[model samples]
Target: MAPSNRPIRIAGCSGSASDRRHAMAMLAANCAHDPIDVIIGDWMSEGNMTGRAALKAEAMPAYEPTFLKSLEPALLDIAKHKIKVAVNAGASDTQLLHSVVVKMVRSKNLHLSVAWISGDEVLPAILDAKARKESPFENICTGEVLEEWKFEPLYAQAYLGGLGIAAAFARGADIVICGRVSDASPVIGAAYWWHRWQRSDLDFLANAFVAGHLIECSSYVCGGNFTGFKALESKGWEDIGYPIAEISASGAVVITKNKGSGGEVSVHTCTSQLLYEIQGPWYFNSDVTAILDDVHFEQLSVNRVALRGVRSGLPPLTTKVGITAKGGYQAEMHWFLTGLDILPKARMLQSQILTLLAPHRSRFTKLTFTLNGTAAENATDQPAATVDFRVFAQAPCEEDLSPKRFFRPCFDVIMQGYPGATPHLDYRLGMPKAFYEYYVTLLPQAAVEHRLHSGDGRSLKVDPPRETRVWPRQQPSCAVTENGVRLGGFGRTVKGPLGWVVHARSGDKGSDANVGFWVRFRDEWDWLRTLLSVEAVKGLLGEEYNGKDIDRFELPKANAVHFLLHDHLDRGVSSTSSYDFLGKNVAEFLRSRHVDLPIKLLNRGKI
Candidate 1:
């Protein structure tokens, strides 16, 4: 098929593997009025890959079985429309998923050609590199040496480019299944194939990349996780629709949701997703590096936002690789302190717990006492007066957290604790559970064994991009000046939640947390840009700031300030003991902080 100038419509069906199964059917059912050229689904995540590895270890299918179930409702519509499908639900076993899907398609009497891309599994490659005394597995976030990781790496999956996916579509594939392609690869691949874009189409590729990122989270751009949920209260979120992207030949994309579906697709919703989990203003992909600092959004119509001015550069030579290993066992115990002296009761209990763990403390890799919640003065309800004091312990051996050693100490301390100390009383919730630790590092895109199994018996290799660029890994330093406005002289101040004036979105990247704050009005951006500094953020973080390194990036075009806090999640959600495991609460926490906002900007109404 030759490239066409007409816009290609791609509907985002799934965000993560567990996303609702209705989107695939929703788009297909509404196709007549809202004709879409392709359907894009994303099913891969950093933590899910490790779980898939464990399944492989058990001699079970590593692919997400839920994805297979998801295809059933859309099968007939897919055949009727001849819609091209692409997804990364193959996880650790692309071939197995391919066989299963092919079997399903044949049983349904449909002649849809399915392709599965491989070579995302790079554990053997990492081992071979280690044997050659090469260090390709250094921790990307902390710069820790491989020797320091200690745990044996069971599996490593490198993020592959979209070329393999694009090639699959080129080879008459009705569906493309991928193992560990970047999350945006499906949309980028489908766009590349639809547009017949070459490796040199950097600008087009980058544009598709951002569009994919925005809608890949499905309903997120349709008010799923929007900060302005109050506005969506009347819209009924029970069935918030999934997102869609209409990409033009020039690479500009218009983001919208399923036709007549609930929820929304406003500029704020689009920008909220645009800032999600991104490392910096420059987004790195195996095929292209997107310069997002210049990107802007324009609301074309209700529930329709156009992403514009996303320039591009050469492809990055390196892509992210996730190495998974046994992180050991972790357990937690919680106690409630109600009524008076919450902090004093928490301290007393902490001191007692430390005494109990003093003998076996060295056995634990991590020992933490976290006090959650605060008592309101003259509280009206019992729950309002209560605060939780949690003690978390992690060790290489599960036995270290056994009832006699860990829980017994916890139980014994209850009698000697504060006057109102009471256990949280959930045994299983506090029991030791095994988890995997993820080690991330950048590997050469050329090193990824990109392969395309085009529904034929042969598996063909997809070569690396012909042109690549070596961009600096470091983010540009923050500047105090923004629209030539100084921080102090802007306007009158008020002590209120920063959220009163700012909208924020946050997510996890490896072991770090990234939070993005943006303003509603153009003039507010000037004040926001000047008011928010690394120091200001540190103050806002308060107790959550554990003195870890933070990287700040200014996105003038998006009217956003992005902050990346290193080692914030204690090795990401897979093994973290954090209350907000995914870092989704980071933005909310920051927004809730009391700050001196300019009354001038605050009077414009909250974002």
Candidate 2:
């Protein structure tokens, strides 16, 4: 079939490991709606990758089991409709996943072609680089060199691009399974294959890149975890729809969701997902470097938004490789302190526990004491006024951090503990479990030996596209003016939550956190822009801000300001001791912060 000017519609099925049920729901929804030409599934996460690596070491299957389980119900429909599937559910074992899929298809007597892409695994290459005395693998966020690591890594995998998957489809493969490709690469590959886009088509590639980023998280772009969830309540967020992208030959895109699915797809929702994990204006992927500063979004109608102005250049020489190592064993416990003097009660309990463990302090690699929530004054319910004191400790091995050794001390102090204190009844939290430490560093893309296997004794090698131009490193800059602007003309001002006039979203990138906020009206953009600077963000973060490096960028077309706070999530989601490990609620916390708003803007009801 010749390439046509009509836009290609592609639907995203799963976002991560926990999205299996929703993913199956989306498959049915996709078949009922304007049928999708391609379906993309992103099921791998940083934590999931580490778990899969551990499984592989034990000589077990390392692929995501949910991938086949969820697809089985819709496999017949997908085959009958000829809807191509490209997914990264292969995790650490693409070859095994390929075999399993082929067997399943044969059992069903389906004449579909299956392909698998490999070579993202770079453990041997990393060992070779180390032996050759190549440059040290410094941690991308913390700058800690690899030589300082105390334990050997369990596995290392580089983030691959979409060219391999695109080539698989070019060879007439109906299903493509990939190991460790970037989450958005499946969408990128599908768009490239469907559009027949050339390697040097940077503009088209950038457009597709932005489109993929917006919908890579499935229900996120459909208002699932939005900060302005109160406003979306009328849209029925319980059964939120999965996102879909309609891409034209020119590379322009319209983002929407399944027709009868719940959730709103407005410009606000799109902007929220755009700022999820980005570091700067330049978003680097293996295929291209997308310049996101000028990307614009416009609401065309209900549940439809048009995207434009995305530009791209050649990607950087390096790709990121995630190295997971057995960090140690960790155990945590919580105690509730109720009513008055909660802080003192928590402190007293902590002091007693530390005193009891003082003899064995040397065994611990790290220990933390955290207090969550504050006792409310004049609260009626007992549980409502309680504060949670959490104790988290890590050691070199499970023997040093076992539940029996840790829990006995807490139990011993309970009889003599402070007033109104009670230990949380969850026994599982005290159990020792191994923790995985993640190290992210860069590797040259040229070193990756990517290849596509057609599953029937046929394979082909793939190479990175030739670079057409040099891409510069993005610098930190803000739209803030040196002199403070005047807000006098707006008449009276009211002190209220920033959510009254702006929508915000925040998420984690390893240990760092990114928050983006925007206003609805163009007139409010200038005031909102001027009010929120890097310094303003620091103030909003309060004590959590500390003195870490922060980067700021302005997306004028989207009327938004974005900030990246380095080392803010306290070592990321998997091993973090923070109450909010994923940083999902950071944006909501900032939105709840009180701010001075213009009376006129509030009177106009523009928010």
Candidate 3:
């Protein structure tokens, strides 16, 4: 296929702070190779945003320090290559980030224009709306009205789109810093600018949206945090390359990685990421609603996959707003139990701790005891056979959650507690720290006034395209199972892990968890759909399934089934006390659950 007029090549350099070193490495690698039109970084995550909000509350700069630090190493190369940089690393303060970037450019004697996209912050708007009783502000996840919130919010920011970014680029910005724009907005903006696409070009925008989503996490499409990690390890995981998207004028996207870089980019890897964190087939972004129900991927060659069949339409009237507030202080302690009767030992420890805290029980708002892991049979090492018992306590004030008052009980019963009781070496685990609760809801997009400010003392207001038509929200259809595999008719069945027949990717969306499961063959789609119904999913979750609402959607083109489990994360990642706060491991845990597999499909040897 002939390329379309200088197809825009955008490289994603960063995922989050955890991948900062690798992100910088990717940037350096990109600098050494052919110049990419845009190098994007995603530094704003739920955890990072909450922390940055707290910092802003404390009168500290809202911009992320690590973002500047990571970019410094490759700044010269970036300028020399004239690679336009875009990042959401501004966190809560894009103005400060803009100034810092400008100073850095001047210090290096480099001529580069820096711009920032603002208007994501809507705390004042929210306050006004609430005071005026404009509308009943309800939490999108919990449906609880804002008036019922226990704590006043410290920060509220709506998720912006790519219009402001595109405007900045049009205004000759060499680097664009943004706060709380969707992670994929940078790539979307770059593609829109390069293609000269209008706001109504939903198809092209949808393609870029999917492409941006794939590479937004940087190494995710390059095999990092992949379900098929064993296969990626063989291809060298340590030096995994970051993802790059080659977008055609028509919106077709080719996902590839840096040449000679480690890790592989195949259909499976791209598919794994495509399914991450999505609510349903209709991916609602502020810019466009990407219809991924028909989206499919094809491997073009080694380390290259072509994304196709995606469609798009006008987005919803409202954009998501994330509000962060102080939820009080939390403290936790861990105890290790080993050998036989692990449950009994954990129970005994919990009982003793509770008995010791009986006098001070009234001070705590909530107390929890979680037992993690089980003893492994024939384990060679003692650590391998140990189970962890965790006690978490939350209170309205730090004094009530102080280590001397709350964590003292755990240490006091060390000698008299259950046999083989041991605690982790980290003493700071007993210290109380403020917890930030996240409340996500929707706000009218028209209410947000997105503006792009250029270094040349010029500002432009960017607005969403005028609505040509309004379409009713699409509801998830029932699971399709007409051609589903019938186990009884397939001779014999064997009980095994579901992973033998399906590939799954799971992630968090506020307090909810979304898990997408797909099959390699189209013939297995019905079987997958039938085998993983809502009831089946609940069963797969076993003890963790808390009888919450579960919505399922089917994607025929991808031969996949997606599920959204509401209120599954216990109140989002920041306040969640669960081990898998982000729900990153939910799919893997489900895959491990034993299920009845058809003998015929197992014998096919394609799984």
Per-candidate clashes come to 0, 0, 0
Evaluate residue 254 in candidate 1 and report its C-alpha lDDT on the 0 to 100 scale.
Answer: 94
Error of 3 at 144 (Å): 1.0
**CA deviation > 4 Å runs, candidate 1:** 1-4, 482-484
Off by over 4 Å in 3: 1-4, 22-32, 468-474, 477-483, 603-607
Write the residue-wise lDDT of candidate 3 on 6-69 in tens digits: 8888999888866655465356546656447788989888887888888888889988778887
lDDT of 1 by residue, 1-607 (tens): 3346898899999989889987887687678788887888889888798889877867888998888878888988888887888988899998999999999999999989999999888888778877787764678787886776788988889998788888888888888888889988888998898888888889999999999899888899899888998889788777898888999887879999887788888888888999899988889888898988878899999888999889898988878888889989988888988988888888889889888877788889998888888988899999998888888989899988887768778768877778977997788757888888888987777777899998876678999888898888686657344464765776678899999989999999888899889999887787887788888899999978999878888878778888888888888878888999889999999999998888887777776
Distance from true position, residue 376, model 1, in Å?
2.4
Question: How much lDDT does each candidate structure score?
Answer: 0.85, 0.82, 0.84
Per-residue accuracy of model 2 over 1-607 as CA lDDT, tens digit each: 2235678787888888788454653564467556687888888887787788777767889999888887777778778777888889999988999999999999999988999999899988887887787958877777778888776887889999888888888888888999899988887888888889988888888888888888888899998787667777678877888888999888889999988778889888888888888888888888888888897788999999998778887877888898878878888888888898877787889899989888777898888988888888999898789888888888888988765568677657888899865888887878889887777888888788989998566888888767834444345566463454576656689998888878888888778788888888887777877889888888888977769888888887898888888888877776777878888788888988888888888886634
Pairs clashing in candidate 2?
Answer: none
Candidate 1 is scored at a TM of 0.96
